[model samples]
Target: MILFRRRTLLLSFFVAMLVFSMYLMMSGNYPKVIYRDSGVPDAEKVSTEDSIDSTDIESVISTNGSGRDFFVEYRLERDRLRSQEADYLREIINNPNASQESKDKAQKDLIALAEKVEKEMNVENLIKAKGFEDAVIILSGDSANVIVRSEGLSTKEVAQITDIVTRTTGLSMDKITIVERSN
Candidate 1:
């Protein structure tokens, strides 16, 4: 009975987090990306390259305001998505009518989800410790995307970030794509 109550509390906390994140996303606190039909040819559109220059970011930020932090918004969105996934897993685990097999799978998934969250947090902290102003990392299957808050990254800086990600995430250098988010 105590265990069940604890699970209930945990579920409630996650639900609250999800709701708060959604509110932030919907409240116009962050810049919204607008797709417009400029007469520019598709071939002449903004480069979709990994390195997003300050000019690119400035144009995007111009729509809303200057004080927006891309890293913070990305982190909030990531947390919101994870929170929703966790809430669904919790529901499956807590459903009394769920079969044992389904509950077991849900429990396994939940543990994996927690581990992924912790690993991402650790990687972010480690990156910041390396003197970055801010960093956001997203790990998927065998690939990881590391976006750092900077106008540009030197070769050495890229090496440092790549090493940190490879060491922390066990992803090969080729599989990790590092990008710069200009402040």
Candidate 2:
């Protein structure tokens, strides 16, 4: 009888403990919760109404008044046209069915179109002509250098040719260098 009574008491104790644990969980007061502090500064405590001390307002005004916004828009348009022209050239070069004759004709047509565009836009004509060997224009430190490596042209002749090119391009004569290579 004593063993039975002890067993009943132990069972009742376990049930009470379980109910107490459930109540604590449902009430949400068993585990202490902690919150992290946000690192933002209080705007109300900071002063931001200070006046700027700068004496370049007049200079800024003068610089800003120099040109219309249309100038930038026109430059963007010109850049777009140049990009399109490059794409067209690439397409022409990559066409497998393009014969040598057709390619030559296409190149001539492209140059004419480019000249027309240059005249209309007041852009400098950078490329004059291309032959069996490439003609390169080298601009180094305010000097224009034209180098052609092909056929029978002496160093002196190349220099003279470069001078002529500089004169025709309206570039400074002192800044132009021409080099030619003979095969």
Which candidate achieves the best lDDT against the true structure?
Answer: 1
lDDT accuracy of residue 39 in candidate 2: 29
RMSD of each: 9.1, 35.9
- Superposed by TM-score, candidate 1 places the C-alpha of residue 88 at a distance from the truth, in angstroms, of 0.4
**Deviation in angstroms for 111 in model 1?**
0.8
How far does residue 152 in candidate 2 sit from its true spot (Å)?
56
For all candidates in order, the CA lDDT equals 0.70, 0.43
Per-residue lDDT value at 112 in model 2: 49
lDDT of 2: 0.43
Assess the local accuracy of residue 127 in candidate 1 as a C-alpha lDDT between 0 and 100.
86
For candidate 1, write residues 1-183 as lDDT tens digits: 865775676556556656865886798644565434442424433334422223443433343243445676456446656767777887898899999899879877776766676677778878888999888787776778788988889999999999998888788999988888786
* Candidate 1: segments with Cα more than 4 A from true spot: 1-67
